[model samples]
Target: MTREQFIKRIAPIAVQLRAEGSPIFPSVRIAQSILETGGTINPWNNLVGYKVGGGAITPYWQGKSVRKLTWEVYDGTRQDRVPADFRAYDSIEDGYRDQDLLFEKDRYRRVREAENPEEQADMLYMSGYATDPNYAVKLKMLMASYGLGRYDEEAVQLRKEWQERLQQLEQRKQALQARLQTLRQALAMTEIPEWAKEAVERAVQSRLIDTPLNGSYDFYRLLTILKRRGVI
Candidate 1:
């Protein structure tokens, strides 16, 4: 697949991982996956090339695994192609989730605290997440080439927009609740007309006014109640 196609396929998974509060930046994760799998689908579906070793599989992984010839740099000098056991997944999402679990381990504690994608990549390299000496650099290069950082930026902007919308909704809710309170107080006055009293009673009976009302109510909710009771 072309780079665009590969990115398009993983973009949703990256967004999903971000939304689920994965500490790893989606862009970095995508770039790493692209590098590990060579931007192609592998039979193992091991996006991160997660290894199965040190009894990591016995108690937890009941699924299948595949032994593949992988490149490993030893003593910071030599590269060797050796067979290693990599955990296989049923789907891409499951592989991503296992990556998250791996980050939660003590070995990746520093990586989890990395402030940004570059830092996270650096931490992964320092933490021995990969044997490639240039792992971090390669991941960063891939990220830049594919414009993957935009995904992280887009996620941030979307979250900010959602927060602003929620704030506006909350303000409107408070305003509606205050209006309802004022209307209730007005109805409580001794000189309230019988028609107003009847309308208030109807609103209460319709459950528009909660008993001992103390919480905010949405404006549209109040409008719907008023319309339904013919009080609008």
Candidate 2:
């Protein structure tokens, strides 16, 4: 299949990963696959930059390698190729599954705190996967360029819900704060002993207040009344 065809085929796999609660950044990984494999329909379906033979042999890519014009390694330079652990799969879903498994390994314990594709890719590096220094930067750039930052609608919706809840909490906190302030002012003015007028005055000036016991703003109005009378 063509590159676009491959992306279309694997997009649903990415979606499924999201549905299954896998926080892997599929978009970033997919972009890296594109860059590494040259496209989806290449001779070898090596998606995750896996060299051929699958071991610590030489960097010899027996299968198809992506065309790199400048470097011999990029241009099928199989001389220094090392045989690494390349998980073979029958389908794109299998490839994606391996990717998810790679992330789930104990080495990737930091995946949960990874907030972006770059961080996710970096974790992969930290876990001793790819040794490329620019792995995270390239993956991040590709994700941004292709708008692949949002791998699935489910993740996007989850983020949206969290943001909405945060907004609501902030609004409630503000409302509660205002109500508490009003209540504090009201309490300071209520049932003045006539001897504590100076104390009330000091309290009002200091603004060191607390929540109101009552739901009404009568306490604040009472304080205003006291102020007018010069009692506090």
Q: Look at candidate 1 and give me any clashing residue pairs.
A: none
- Cα deviation at 194, candidate 2, in Å, is 72
Candidate 1, 119-154: lDDT as tens digits? 999999999998888999999999888889999987
Per-candidate TM equals: 0.68, 0.50
The 0-to-1 C-alpha lDDT of every candidate, in the order given, reads 0.78, 0.59
lDDT value for model 1:
0.78
Q: Per-residue CA lDDT of candidate 2, range 148-190, in tens? A: 7666555667667777999999999999999998768665543
Residue 19 in model 1: lDDT? 62
